[model samples]
Target: MTTRQDGERRRGRRPGGTDTKAALLAAAREVFIEQGYDGATVRAIARRAGVDAAMVNHWFGGKEALFAQAVLQLPFNPQELIANLLEGDPDSVGERIVRTFLTTWDAQDGGVFAALIRSVASHDQVANALRDFFIKNVFSQLASVVSVDGRAELRANLVASQMIGLGMVRYVAEFEPLARTDIDTLVKAIGPTLQRYLNGPID
Candidate 1:
């Protein structure tokens, strides 16, 4: 029933309007899970949301910021995570990674990551979205930092296993030993194993 003129008038009247932002967020989640971070384009997300591609920039700044808000719901931007991890010496990357991750989660006060884990536990779609986010954002970034001969995918998976396990135990279940332990102790205990996964020779 709507004509082209009506559509043009609506588009021009509310560029990146409130409703458009919500639609973009929902569409980006589906597209990100379907195509992943590296494959999902801003244009595709905008098209899915039925908005102009420039609306993405106007509403969320860019794909990375949009993704951070749409998926993680954390207080910080995920795109900066890799740059933060790679700031110091390469030899201590594992230590830095563990420390940074724990610090970030703890600071959230069971807000972002906890909700994500709960959603992932309850729904397969949410789980797939979370998996894609981790694989594309966290695992791939860390794997890229290591130049070892091992399969980066394998290495990334191993790292994900350790970190994700630590999160569930330390944050969700609140295991006494790990939950009570100081951050330094955790870094010392878990960092070496992650370091080996990153740079050590695998058999």
Candidate 2:
């Protein structure tokens, strides 16, 4: 049953499923942007992509992984970052965090992170998705090792705040001194603040 519209025949999956992954990624990005991470279901993404729901799992593992690959496009993997950060001394985790994060972003030197921040800032849905993604992926990992007296959620948010601030000034806004400073300088200046946010007693 082929329907002809605009003098073109609609088609189904190709023999080899050449575009399956690409289709999923494209559909996931749109669905995520419109419906947000929570609102966008794997079924919905698959439906929109013209593939079976199970195909999402087969190709991308699941929704969260799909979202990370499709929308976030982060240069480094969150799990890998956690593993590397944990390899160092527990007390120096804060410094490791700053250095690793800055190094990753700096080496990439691409506008992907900046664009992501801009997207979150401009759209409510995207902002919500980003927050959820961060809490689930980034902050949760940090909170695992960073022991706060209480208000762990607040502590996570505070750590996020410091990282976001650094990103904004150094990468997005290109603020002087901070932007021009080397990675070590940044690690020195910002490391202790993040350390405190991660483990210090809240007053």
The Cα error of candidate 2 at residue 47, in Å, is 18
Clashes of 1: 0
lDDT (10s digit) by residue, model 1, range 1-203: 33556546656655677988987898887776566666679977877776788999998889767766776655566669767887778889889888988888888665445555665666565567667877778776776677567577787788778988999888888889888788999999999878878877656
Clashes of each: 0, 0
- Local lDDT at 95 for model 1: 92
lDDT (Cα, tens digit) per residue for candidate 2, span 1-203: 21233112212552216487877888887787677667789977877776677778888889877876876765567767877796767777778889988888888553656656766776676677777877877777776777856678888798778888888898889888888799998889888887787787667
Q: Each candidate: what lDDT? A: 0.75, 0.75
Q: For candidate 2, report its TM-score.
A: 0.68
Candidate 2, residue 11: how far the Cα is off, in Å: 12
Winning model by TM-score: 2
Off by over 4 Å in 1: 1-73
